[model samples]
Target chain A: MTGDQFPLWAAIAVSVLLVAGSLLMLAGCIGMVRFRSFYQRIHAPTLGTSFGTIFILAGSVVYFTVTQLRPAVHEVLIFVFVSVTTPVTLMLLARAALYRDRIERVQDVPASKDPLDNAEMQTSKKPS
Target chain B: MSRVLPYPLLTLSLLIMWLLLQQSASPGHILLGLAIALLASRAMAALQPEKPRVIRFLPIFRLAGRAVVDIMASNIAVSKLILNPNSDMTKSGFLTVPLELKHRFGLAILSCIVTATPGSAWLEYHPEESEVLIHVLDIENDQEWIDTLKYRYETLLLEIFG
Candidate 1:
């Protein structure tokens, strides 16, 4: 209604992006609650982290770019940081969980092996 | 170039990231970013991580495109599985797949791709055994997941990194 209102097409695109992002994030949280085990729970939040965050950030980028009348790409930093850091934290946490499961002898975890010898055996088995 | 910047790509990306963060490309910011990038690359040199070699560039883009499509499809699949009340949880399980790709950087990228996709989490990777264990949500067929990784991702990664 106002003079400052977003253009119709831009508004539609932004709305769709934001809605899809929120839905993905909501689904991710639901997955966390619905899953049965720690391992399973780990996969849940990735939904939010991967495409969810990307969609939301993209929406922000589109909205700001239109409003500012310039290329507003700074939101990409959040995208890059989130995409990189989430995996690192998740990987570390997964490794820690693996270590704990091995130490505690928790059920269903693959057994740990000698790092050095295992590498050698794999290399030796290479067909080349 | 090597003497001044051990990792030219790292330095360039760091400088670009600094400029992007500050949202400026003025001379002062450029100078500061260059200095920071130089210092950071020097610091990185001390750690001495193995240098990643990208043999073919086109496959990287192809892989990225495939990943985006796959992630989008899997996101829908996973959301449906999670939302369904009657879906069985017992079907989800951990799987170990042997890998032939040996480059450390390639392996790292593969893990990121796997984890970033919804419904799959990279659990444990044994470099010596050339195997990685992943926790998959709603894994109806183990061979399907194995083929997805080995053929879809690993082959491209080997082409790029080897």
Candidate 2:
């Protein structure tokens, strides 16, 4: 079945929603490029994950459900998976960035305690 | 059960994805999906990644709900800043917050949550020190960001996966 078979009003509504969502995603991509710092740019992808994926998935569900005359909730899984995974990737990237900064001792970053300093306390032998 | 579905969750999700994409509930389609899922799980099993033990699942739902709402709110706020060029809403900077939870799986999940949200991005982490560095879109107050991440996310993640 094609989208044309669906009611014209429904098609228009879905198309509008999809377009708006895509625009949001496009804006996010622009933000990535316009932002100067790596950390600053990291916020761009969330535009894609937060509402970008949701809108696209929503459109898919609406189209499928309307055309087939059956409810389609399974697409919720895509939303679930993407929302969950995007954060994980971002966190790792952030941590990696921080590691690089600390090792280099970049100025302005707050000082952190050395967890390794306590390792000798747990050891059986005394320090030389 | 273990032999048949090396990764039960993965297999089930694969099967669901297959059905959703195919939009078919026929017996033949189900068989095909099962076969694909089985093969996929086998491939995944070969990776030998450390198995994540979920001590509490309910907290995960709460965490997810909180994340969704925050992301949405941040998205709106960031978009407004982007739309207005004249405004001085562009003070972006990195932040470092100390962490207590050390589990790799939990840390990974935390990273994703931070990155997925707008207005802030996880930039780096130090395993030895257990500290996370993040970039905030508009850094009006630094302590606010640190406290939010620690109290809002770290607290719940510790309950769920720790």
Candidate 3:
């Protein structure tokens, strides 16, 4: 059977890794729905992108290493890309949200530290 | 030597990536990967970007190990926060930490490390003031975070990039 393609121990390890990774992702999704504010919600998705991606990639590495009998670590490229891009995109979205909030004068959001944005915000508020 | 191979590390990594992607170690594949890596590295040299010098190997490895452990720990911490309906988020808020690690590459690596952790996010950085704005999911003690960041990460990064 195709089930016997890999050893039982490898199968068990892969299964555990996959399940744990998916549960982390599911928790991240639940967090997205549960959190109240935009800034709070922003932290939720990182759960999936960080260790969640690493765990799943780890499972792939283990399975491929067992079957192919070679170190198959190219899956690490995905983790690298995710780790780099996730923060960049998250930072951009957060800055955009902050800018919008500052212009609208949301009470909790701190004023812009960026002088250029500070000037633009000043103009945006004064014109209103 | 430096002229032909502007970045030995970059070329070597690209070659390794090519071989891994192709999943082969044949002589022809190695030669082809070398050629591609050489061409790509030359293109990179055209940009004339200052390469980050990882001066110390030990701190680099240490930082990587620490980041992995912290990521796992924070995953559990964030998951607990998500699962507990009664968990209050009043303690969650933004933190502004002034940084002395002025090296651009050091700052970038620190940002990646901070943002990669699940319970924290890197929001913005003001280079003029040399400060970073981060959002922490659970910040019971602000000083603790500031200390952890400055001592744990920024110090290691400064060593590596220095």
Candidate 4:
């Protein structure tokens, strides 16, 4: 809120981070539309979620830390949470997509293999 | 110590997180954070997920630095692909790579690393076959991606976890 009080170096850093973060998110959106297939499109949003969120939140952390004259590191909670949760959600979505593709008899995706049988076969083969 | 806190590191981190969120180091807040952290660790102990033993701290730092660099590089690369007028020049496809790292904790970290990188996404992992299916936005060469994963992240993860 107090732009005048914000130091020049912190201001430049925050601005750079904000610009870079927004650009990454923009690229992600562009990829989501540009990619041909569902699988290809899925990789797009991670750009925004991973480093995009990181940069924006990091800028916030720096800005707040400078302005507040305290650590103000709570922004890290969002960073940690986003970094952890994004992969989980993406993995689940990917699995669901794979399942749907299998049901529909999609051509590109490999056929679903039973996880238990696969494990057993591996273990049995290792003994030889 | 074990009885009081099942996961000392987890409890300590949670306490730090709580204090950060509160933005104060008052005695009351510290006590409350300690209580919550203890309770959360106890709950975690009940779940009993594989406790990842980090034998080396240096590898963790190295991995973190490597990840940051990779993410930054990929972000630029992917941005270029997206912004290019002739995007069709780039090929996007799936590639499955066999993995030697079998530790669940290590695999999870690997998944996060792969998925977090802009151009790659972890599609499916077969625990039994020790293979991971990843979709690459630009699949110029499959072996290169495999080598990058194996050398860049997996080796560091093996060192940290083992």
Candidate 5:
């Protein structure tokens, strides 16, 4: 317990990590704006969710552990949960978009042609 | 019974989350967190989301273990490709694999599993067509990717969550 206060070195390290995380998050947001298509733009948030959150959580783990002298790694839960959930949302959104596209016969995405594929797919769709 | 706590499982998670975040077990903290959890459940009741029923528990653990290992390996692979641009990295592409599981919870789990793995990302799924569109970091063998998804993830998810 280094006096149970945030040491100057820990403060500097945490600040640097926070700034880097924020910058990565900003770059991801920029990627969302710059990308041309929805599919392309979907790649942007991975930067924030994957490496960005990892850095922030690592900083939290370090700051708390160093200051408190007892391990406080539970904040890693936030990082893990967010990383897991973001992809799920993106997947569902993409699926919804694809569903709409197929219904409208959109030309952007390639459509499958096999009848067996169609039958296989039909077995999974239950009317909601 | 009120629809608010239709699932006590979520309530347990909320309590655990509160404790973890606070990193404390003081009586005052526990009381305050319990209040918050109750209020949050009330709010959730308003949404009226369909409650997911998890059937098997053991397979869920196995799936998580697999996901952890795969994500770590994929992270190394993707990092290598990013570090060395001309290391003969295969140009990324998409594959549409037909699926058998229809339950929303199972599908959601599948999405998380696919996207969290660094070298691949879940791009889309067509519910009407029952096919999932995934973008691979390296796209050399489309069949291999499809096979991996079907066997590695879809199989276990169907068994556990479906």
Candidate 6:
């Protein structure tokens, strides 16, 4: 946010990055409404979470490093944290959604997956 | 070395995370961060998660680079699909992809890659069947998508984790 100390080229680059990141995020939100199915809607926010955040974080890093005269790659923690955690959340959510759809005997659910019964809803289904 | 640091890599990363958060490399911060990292690593060791044995290191970077390129490309594609009025929305659907890479860690990384990209969301992984169910935002062709998953990412993952 503190960009007054930034020179002309840095300002342009940061602004462009920040704007592009915001636009990607805006499109992601719009996608939540634009897409119809719950499954399809799941892919929307990743636009913001993945590269959108990257661009924005890059801008922040550039801004801070230039302004403070220090390496501001700390935002990499956010990137690493998100990359590590978002998949777990999205996978669980998608599995729960798919489970509910399968249980309700919803049409168009992938036939390859067996319908979950009350007893079989375990998270450790992966073969260790 | 192994006795003092049960998980050297995990402890090192935690220490680095603490330093990054503090944004300082001062001696006081380093000692404090080391203590915190040791404590955290001990706590993590209590959970007894199976440490992934990465057989090769180089392909890991290659896979990451390829995934980055794909992410950017898909980000644009999905954004265009979101914005265009005349875009065909019906092409989006679920696809069952048969996977050959079965290493648990490899599968975990694959899930991250698939879900981290904009145009796809990994729905369910069938470990028993060695297949995964993924939802594609724009499924122009099922075979093409399958090939992309298998060849583009899975092959490199096999090199790194399999």
List the candidate 1 regions with Cα displacement exceeding 4 Å.
A1-5, A115-128
lDDT of 5 by residue, B66-94 (tens): 88777656655554544453555336666
- Error of model 1, residue B9, in angstroms: 1.0
Which predicted model would earn the best DockQ? 3
Please state the i-RMS of candidate 5: 4.4
Docking class of 1: medium
By lDDT, the candidates rank as 3, 1, 6, 4, 2, 5
Ranking by TM-score: 6, 3, 1, 4, 2, 5
Which runs of model 4 end up more than 4 angstroms from their true locations? Answer: A3-5, A69-71, A115-128
Please give, for residues A1-128, the per-residue lDDT of candidate 5 as tens digits. 35645678988889888887776667667656654556555655676677668778888787877777666747667876897678867777766665556555556666655466556555655333
Return whichever of 2 and 5 wins on lDDT.
2
- Residue A96, candidate 5: Cα error in Å is 9.4
Against the true structure, candidate 1 reaches a TM-score of 0.91
User: What are the TM-scores, per candidate, against the unseen true structure?
Assistant: 0.91, 0.77, 0.91, 0.89, 0.69, 0.91
Lowest summed lDDT window (length 10), candidate 6 chain B: B139-148
- Error at B150, model 1, angstroms: 0.5
Off by over 4 Å in 6: A1-5, A112-128
Candidate-wise lDDT, in order: 0.86, 0.78, 0.86, 0.85, 0.72, 0.85
Q: Weakest 10 consecutive residues, lDDT, candidate 5 chain A? A: A119-128
Residues B62-155 of candidate 6 have per-residue lDDT tens digits of 8989999999999998999999988887788888888889888888888998998888889887777887889998887678778879999999
Supply DockQ values for each candidate.
0.57, 0.39, 0.68, 0.57, 0.21, 0.67
Tell me which of candidates 5 and 6 scores higher on DockQ: 6
Show where candidate 2 strays beyond 4 Å.
A1-12, A69-128
- Each model's fraction of native contacts: 0.69, 0.64, 0.72, 0.73, 0.25, 0.83
Models, CA RMSD each: 6.1, 6.7, 2.4, 5.7, 6.9, 4.2
- Docking tier of model 2: it is acceptable
Which segments of model 5 are wrong by more than 4 Å?
A: A1-48, A51-74, A92-108, A111-128, B1-4, B87-90
lDDT by residue (tens digit), candidate 3, A1-128: 24466788989999999999888999999999998888889989889998888889999898887887567767887777788899888888988888778888886987777778878876775323
